[model samples]
Target: MAKGSRADHSARLAAFSAGIRATRGGKSLDINATKLLVAITQADDADRLADELVAKGFRLTRLKTHGGFLRRENAAALIATTEDRLPAALAIIRQTCRARTVTWVPPFPDGIGGIGPAPMEIEVGGAVVFTIPIEGVELLGGDVAESLARTRAAGGAQ
Candidate 1:
């Protein structure tokens, strides 16, 4: 390949990689052996928890969700990491998302008559985590590929 052709190839590869990363919430393809889908019910704690997780070297893809029972705002954080790092991710979530008591009024019943909505206290603000196994990961180019290369060079698990 010519010198200019090589540069063009690099630029094209970078753009392709960036497109992939953008679809995944700008998170790099860390190529981990395990994937964790952590559903955090308390929307209020999402920002802080996400920042802390990133600081600890974990990449996350956040999804805005709603709770079925409470019908309240919730967030689901998708984290990909090696099996060895699973405990660390879980620990961060546990430490960041603390359970707390919340008071709310229950919705009125459909058939019952002369009954008013009553306040109820319940516990909330905790994370529900699910672990999944990832078979493989492929990075196109750019910083994500470089990072993956560095991880492999350091003898980290693929």
Candidate 2:
């Protein structure tokens, strides 16, 4: 095969740039929880959503991708929320979930409108991301379990 010179390389680069431009195009509300994390399947969209959330008034804490310990190397965004707005944010998330290709972590208290605040506007291609209640710290064996056991015991053996 004849080794093409600079002209061949330039032509290839031009084609790549044109392809990129042909594809790229683009364009939340409530909440009042303490801390909430939004887990997304795609990192690119996750970051964009984080920026939108911040602009809408929520305080974003961690907006980085994490991978380890059974994690699938997905992207996550953590936002500071108040109590009342949590439910509203959840409703927005569920509505957004109808389109995007991702899973989400709900507010800590669990259930819809648990404790995290609601998002401003749902992304056109966003999905219903599930929530995992994070106590903010790792607990050793017997710590959480034992505490829960005691609490259950205190409930009059029901």
Candidate 3:
């Protein structure tokens, strides 16, 4: 009985150690290599971007957004990837997201009787990408995409 108890204690100790290592961002986790990529894409391109990124083995979260200038539906993709994979991800984004010309009329808060607002040609339908370094990450409750940092830290795919 004593021998069995000792073995069980050892197993529990090993499990605890493994958990600690996983919590400490794993031995393979590198702060510099992990980053958060934020991409703001037009409505037409957001879904495609997310799908492509997922197909390429990237974990990302998509949020519905709106553009200030165009006042149109947009999507914000939050992607987490390693530094080595960043260039490829960026290339995918560039290839998938394209800018196009759009016509818009400015709303005149103060208007004249004869002239209201002039229609102008503007550029739209592109993605804005921002890469931010990750210090530490954890998944709360579950992977609702908040686990990117944590999963990455644990040397797992987020």
Candidate 4:
């Protein structure tokens, strides 16, 4: 019986792997992203990616509050766009993320309340775990071309 069970599990794993490969090679137009632990100082900052995206003539649709990380005030979710624009959107996210940092707050002992004890690290740094094929987005605009153009124009003829 145990040997039979093992064979069954192995078959299931093989089937799952085959399915993933098939999906990748198939012609199903699906664009999605799964970014975890994205730190946005302010909710509005999420739109910072607009300038670059606008230059590309891509429309951004903001999705609902997929969820939040209560412990760290971070967020995880999706923003909709044309399948081809996904890479650009991700690039914007990566650039913005570089300016932000993350720190791990170790829990306090009992009765210490919300305050965390001495944090393990002061500047651990933050990162985004991006997964393709996100559900959708709600708001748009992730380009900064106009701003860049203005800056360039202002500094011209030097």
TM-score of 4: 0.37
Number of the top-ranking candidate, with TM-score as the measure: 3
Screening candidate 3 with a backbone cut-off below 3 angstroms (N, C-alpha, C), the clashing residue pairs are: 137-150
Task: Give lDDT for model 2.
Answer: 0.42
Regions more than 4 Å wrong, model 4: 1-47, 50-58, 61-70, 99-105, 111-117, 122-129, 132-158
Q: Residues 79-112, candidate 2, lDDT per residue (tens digit)?
A: 4354555665555444433444334443356465
Give the RMSD in angstroms, all C-alphas superposed, for model 4.
20.7
Cα lDDT tens digits, model 4, 1-158, are 26446444333223212111112222221123232122233233445554444465443443334333434334333443444556666676666544333465655688667756665534422335445454432222332223222333454211
Q: lDDT: which is higher, 1 or 4?
A: 1
lDDT (C-alpha) at residue 55 in model 1: 96
* CA lDDT of every candidate: 0.66, 0.42, 0.68, 0.39
Sort order, lDDT high to low = 3, 1, 2, 4
Runs of candidate 1 exceeding 4 Å displacement: 1-30, 110-113, 138-158
lDDT of 3: 0.68
| Every model's TM-score | 0.65, 0.34, 0.66, 0.37
Cα RMSD to the true fold for all candidates? 9.0, 25.6, 10.3, 20.7
Q: In order, how many clashes per candidate?
A: 0, 27, 1, 25
